[model samples]
Target: MTALPRNVPSSTDPHHLPGVRWLRSSYSTGANNCVETTRPAAGPWAGLLAVRDSKDPAGPALLFSPESWSGFTAAFH
Candidate 1:
């Protein structure tokens, strides 16, 4: 398990997060099914989930609560 960063701003607006470093699985090459995640180091949005597509950084992101993301990841396993 990894800890979310503490600097994310509380905005569903998606513009508050800057310098978001997205990472993709090594197995995701050439697939449209790519996903990425980032966390801020401090703010109201800290600890929130920022899920996005590797194909589109400027695209909309899916925000999730810690519990929600946990459940979501569990479902796949």
Candidate 2:
């Protein structure tokens, strides 16, 4: 059986994602306390939107499907 590599990082944590680009809302101040969003381009997490706390980059991230994320924001909009 194939085994996962020790050096390979997992998706639960944003810091583990390689070269991921996180986006922050422009309305948020420069305090870096807001959450960040990024779309993972590959891996098992690919096609899912990843959200994480900017304050704690090493913290766990929340994954949401495209439809779910849209509905979530629509409520606020």
Per-residue lDDT tens digits for candidate 2, residues 1-77, read: 12221222334554466568888867669898798888778767677777877777666777777777887778898
Regions more than 4 Å wrong, model 2: 1-16
**Which model scores highest in TM-score?**
2
What TM-score would candidate 2 get against the native?
Answer: 0.74
Report the Cα lDDT for residue 50, model 1: 76
Per-residue lDDT of model 1, residues 1-77, tens digit only: 24432333333444566545666756687675788777655445567777777777666666677877787789888
* Residue 2 in candidate 2, Cα distance off native in Å: 33
The TM-score of candidate 1 is 0.65
Error of 1 at 44 (Å): 3.5
